[model samples]
Target: MMSNSKEIYESITTKTIVAEINLSCNDEQIDSISLTSEDLQNTIRIEAESSNSTNESYCSNIIEESEYKPDVPTEFVPVVNSVFKSLNLAVKMYNDYAEMSDYKVKKFFELHNHPLESIEERPYTKKARKMSYFEKEFVVHASKAKMGPTMAHKIRAVLKGGYEYVRVKVTDYKNLRRGVNIILCYKDAQIMINKMNDRRDHYPNYSFEFLRDGDMLAVMFWADEREKAFYAEFREVISFDVTFRTNKYKMVFVLFTTVDHHKKSVTVGAGLLSRETTESYEWLINAFLSAHKGKAPKVILTDQDPTIKQAVESVLPNSRHRLCMWHIMRKLQANVTDDLLKNKDFKKRFNKLVWNMHIKPDEFEKKWELIINEFNLEDKRWFNDMFELHDKWIHAYFSDTRMSALMKTTSRSESMNSFFNTYSQFGNLLLHFMMNYDTSIQKQRNTQKELDHLTKKAIYKFISPRPIEKTCCKSLYKYIVL
Candidate 1:
């Protein structure tokens, strides 16, 4: 019975040592314990004392004292001494932990030394001014209206004297702006959902489709009543282009556009896609075509992205596809030397070869071969590919077709891109982008209406009085003397 009790006493003592080490060593000291188990054991032996004795405290007194002095001599077995020198390291680690905890405790009390100001009252000691509930409501409404914090804060200061509200600094508003944006994210999404649900009344025949990948919205295509009407009126030629990172969602903004009679760009359809894959392009194109009653345009102009090209071909098999001449010409400058572009003779020759209206297909081939060999660009892949795909954009091929809108390039689409860039900022909320787009489209249609009125009612000055010219002039509403 005595031996069993001794064993139990030893077990209890071991547990007491473990508890003491745990109470003494802090989170920072845990890494030290992991590295050196022998040091940990030594620490436990030195720190843990008999719990059944008259002294009942377990590490409370030692923690308060902070200073730890070793009881034994340092000189011992050299090999064992070398290994257990980590016990001193463990002591240093505990010291740092204790110092940090004490500093934190001091700072915690120091921060609370001054009492918090009441929400209804301003600071009493200083000439402290606080924004009133009315001012806060105005700032929040301004933020929801998409006014920047600096401007909102300035407006708040301007209204302080007239009302009883106190003026707050821009610095105070800066902190509130971040929380406001987080709230606006979900608020704006819910607002868009409401609009999308009730769009049938305001935008008849409007269509919208969305795909979601788990919780995140993946792709969406939308066409309003105006877009559908524009497509039906002028669907002969269309330019398809996609702009990236135009909204807060980092979505790819796709637009289908065409030129009005006055040569101004008009949007036919618009979409936002989450990815640049072939599947997304296909879905967007399908949605766009379905919205327009699947009436394919005679000619579709675009860049040389293979996925978009393939999607267009698959969706609209009957439409003739054409690459943008300006995009192809950009590659011409990029692939060639700067000196060649600057050289007067080379520049003149290159422009004539690219833009000459009188050059036949055989003549074009002859001139192209000569230019390639003269410029030592025969081995260039870009030059060779343009040569192979000459039928798509080399004006001579499609100039005879009356249905072709003669829009061999996507320059108008590029113009639309720049126009939208001015109104729609990067990382803008999706709903804000759509709202700005409404204003932009309205401006375009208004300009077109003015131009149409001018074309119908205005007269033109004639250069000559020849009978053929007079007869030609009599057949038309009005003509501009070029």
Candidate 2:
């Protein structure tokens, strides 16, 4: 009975009307009545198969029964699918309506609101024209208010309820602050960023700071973690080298260190140099020390710059200053005559003499003495200086497998120097240096990521081909899927 009633009420196909009747007179209610001027005497009947209830109750019954679906399925799809599709449509329509409402509200405020100048309010678009005559006819007030049909204003006015309402709330921002973003647009930033990376100013957390101790200012930089946990896991390893700028007395200070693969891309400390001096280096070192107080490095790698060397040993007493082997080698090559340096046997023997990692210090010293005599470098200025640090160089520190490989040479440090030069040529100011900072680090990271990928690929290809292939696939999937 409920289903029947639902089906009946669901089928509403009439131009409905209701009339009051004399209920006790036994008069019948009409079901299908046709009114015509010619048939004025046509009698009406209730035509009910079962009708004991009141006339209104009977009509209500029919409406309630109309809720059910019909027995016959539509040609299109099942009722369940149709219901789902309808639900989806309803949600979409609701979202669209909400968006439209927001747009209208915003426009209404713009046209009718804001900017507190009291007078006769003039709408942005007063004289408006419509594309169709019906629209013009339907929208009589808008046409009167619009001065000219600026499409933008017209779109706003029409979508936004109207122009009068919109003119009410338009306003200028108060207490707004603005700052200069030199890499103004995305494309420009990209190019400059790329250029900085090429120069190895490093990327991600780039910083350019000028620390002044007296008159000299050092441009400091570090692309380390944002929280700057300058924990020198072992200790501080400072690698310093000087590269010239195109502008004279304008030195681009590129400072960095050697860390584990994971720690390679952090800027623990950095600064710029105007007049590279002891005081200037001292100030920069002090700033780094202040920030990373007890975490001073155990070793600092740098060339034989007297001022920088002195500053490091003085301030960071715990740090063991090691001269960059490359720099030492350069000095060795420079000091020795061309004939002596060109000795192929001497070059090979010297490298063997320096890299005595596995051997004891006494054994290394014994071999070093052999090379000294063979090359006649006993009295040579570079040979003695290079040999002067030999005791510290091949100590128990050099024999330690962990320290030896990482501290073997300043090649990685040189790579960092190359990085700084790649970035510094572009800008002289601090901000300019900072802007290129992250880009340099990102480049290093990207290179490392590539190397990692290649290494994984090679390893997988050789060890377990199928699993490696799957691993490679997973990486690729993640990249492209995102």
Candidate 3:
């Protein structure tokens, strides 16, 4: 009878405490504290029974399954038998026992203090944004196709019906591309090397060389069988120049180009260098020479880069190194006075003297001295420097060099670089750059084949009925037929 009375008293106390806690907590906090009152009551009853037993250790099996029926919702009521009938009553009794036993019960409400974001704004959250496998693959293929992130995103939106249907944002596409590049940064060099190796294995004439600084690739050069054949035939005069901003690593793109029989710019070979130092240029030149069985061109045209000049001199000691006339002439305004450049008489005489190919070197020198004296430009630093290097730039000095007149400037290389830039981008990975380069080469080759076909089928209407004209027409391309 006494035990029943005590149990009744405990159940009332638990219900009062539970009500107080419920009143103090907010709805969110109450939700976060997932522990039900029934569970707390079960624990309290177990502890009480264990304390009364001699064993002292709590055993959960003391509560029989028959004592608590399933599907019976707990409520606030008097304790019947020994089973817990009320969650509120159980919680209050557990708390009182905890207080007496000096147990500090901590209610950890794991709820966020800040208000939650709405469902509409949740997708824009950083944690919620992600790119799936298909999306990443799309980005990779799109990048390879020379489409940027913004264009790729727009195309995806169109394919998906609308921008609203797209799961990821434009920024996500860009971020994925950037992440892919970062991941491939270490493997790209090796991948390129392997690709080149495979090509060389398949085509015996394809050649490539690479230099590394520690484990990082520093320089690379490559030439295919067709390019090698082109070099062998049209290797008399080749223009070499470097283009910048062509890859993610900012590597200098070195191009060796020459005019083919069709008067088209053909790529002889190409290279990439981490830096444009004299040593790097020398290595690249040596690699090119090695690829072509050490046969240097008769005349090589390039810009006014002293490092390239030094490399050419050291590597191709026998080959004539000529400066690009266009590169030098383009700097006239910056190096000379506006008044001097604008003078019609000066421009007329200067253009004639600089461009004349029939004049001898001695006559060219005399004429140059006369122009300087007439213009009163004796103290001009640019003129003095150019005069010192006159042999490299003056057509009269290297006039005898075979096909030198055909490529007097590096314009072919510059044009070829522009063509490549159309297929490539400034933010390209090494693999993508090479892929685009191959595509460009294939397009040029196809164009060359088309031109060859047209030339073969062309029938000329001769203005003069001369055997020499007919012979020339038969031997030369349509553009070169005179």
Candidate 4:
């Protein structure tokens, strides 16, 4: 009975204390104090208990699965195999952990430190070495000595020193030769200039000009006495066109050409211009005229380039300018449809409109409009532009000039380009290119001599055996048989 009475007294005292704490929390007088309430204290205690429970659970799991081993049957032989595997696995795990730790430490240090330069593996592997000055000099000497063999043969001859100092493959040798050519281009030009002056002294009629832009050869014009004599005879009509990428300097190769009496292309003068501009054309044309003693041709045919046209108009006002009909016709396929190009009737009609010298200008205009409208090509911009320039190229307008069938197109210049390509290639040193040009010219002159001999000896039979034809043939010079 006493113990029960004491328990009740203690329980009543505990309830009264909890009630007093609740009353203090709810009272407005204690709102300004910095003490935490019972709710907040309870939340803090719950969070602490959850955190400790999580740590205990994690520790238990880690210890329980710290090192797992596969089960083995007791009846199996070599029971020590399992033990050995576990020991090896433990060693591997230790090694992995050590490697990871080491990697992390190194990464941390790398992040804080300046980076080192990255070195390439096998830096010199499969790369071409730079050619020495002696090797390059030998290449030049060999080329001159052998009279310009292919790059492969040139390499073989150059590496005859047994591949010790010159350890270059064929391709590497070619690249090195190009570099050497570029290096010696200016010197080669100087040598060519000296040679030209020497020729001029020996043959007083030889004319040449040397033009330069800084260290590069800009424009070089040369006409030998034989070339000048040919120009004097065939100066009635001339054509010039620009060819490119035929020398080390990659200069423009401009050829002034004419047609011989036998309808053969003959080169009159040649130039290497660094640029293709109105100024360059102007200078080239002026040089050509000066070389021929200011005798401008009656008709000059060229590709329909606007810069060249403008230069011609400014420099050769007395000369009639005609765009190459062949050049203009080549663009038809690109500008017109395949169906139209395949139509034989359309091609025939187009050729008639372009080539028939009997067609009047008014008739040509009517025919051109009818053809365009019939072909539904009225909206084709290139065709329209070409139609606008018909007077410059059409045969009807060309009738008024004394072109004399000497040149209907710049095909003579194109032939000259094709002929030069047989001997010269792109990136030949400037001097070497000029020397090749001389050789080509000499060959052409030799052919001309052979043709002259043929004409003098061979009697051409007339296609129509008429009395007047025989008389005319008898009266004509052997060179004019064509």
Best by lDDT: 3
Best-to-worst lDDT order: 3, 4, 1, 2
Between candidates 2 and 4, the one scoring higher on lDDT is 4
Rank all candidate structures by their TM-score, best first, as comma-separated numbers.
Answer: 3, 1, 4, 2
lDDT digits (tens) for residues 192-275 of candidate 2: 335545444654444333444464433443335432443444344555555655222355565655564443533455556666
The candidate, 1 or 2, that scores higher on TM-score is 1
Please write out the lDDT profile of model 4 over residues 1-482, one tens digit for every residue.
44433432343223211110122122222112111123222332333333444354533332244332324333321221122122333233333433443311111112222211112311222322455676566555555432343554446645575444345544565676676666776578787778888887898698888677897667778888777877877777788898876776778899999877666888889888888889888988898888999999988888989999999999999988888999999988998778889999999999888888678899999999999999899899998998888877787877766544557788778888988877777767777777678778878888987887787788778899779998877677643643
Instruction: Give residue 482's lDDT in candidate 4 (0 to 100).
Output: 34
For candidate 2, the 10 contiguous residues with the lowest summed lDDT are 170-179
TM-score leader: 3
As a whole number from 0 to 100, the lDDT of residue 355 in candidate 3 is 92
lDDT head-to-head 2 vs 3, winner: 3
lDDT per residue for candidate 3 within 1-482, as digits (tens), equals 44543543344334321221332333332111223345445444544463444433322333332333223224433232223234344456556544554444543222212233444555565545677889888987777567889999999999999987687999989888788788887798898889988998898689999999998889999999899988988899999999998898899999999888877899999999998899999999999999999999989999999999999999999998899999898887797788988899999999899999799999999999999999999998988999999998898988787677778889889999999988788878789899889888999999988888887788889989889989887777644421
TM-score of each: 0.62, 0.47, 0.67, 0.60
Ten contiguous residues minimizing lDDT sum, candidate 3: 25-34
* Clash list (residue pairs), candidate 3: 14-92
Q: Which residue pairs show collisions in model 4?
A: none
For model 3, state the Cα shift of residue 70 in Å: 26
| Alpha-carbon local distance difference test for all models | 0.66, 0.48, 0.77, 0.66
RMSD (Å) per prediction: 18.6, 24.7, 12.4, 27.1
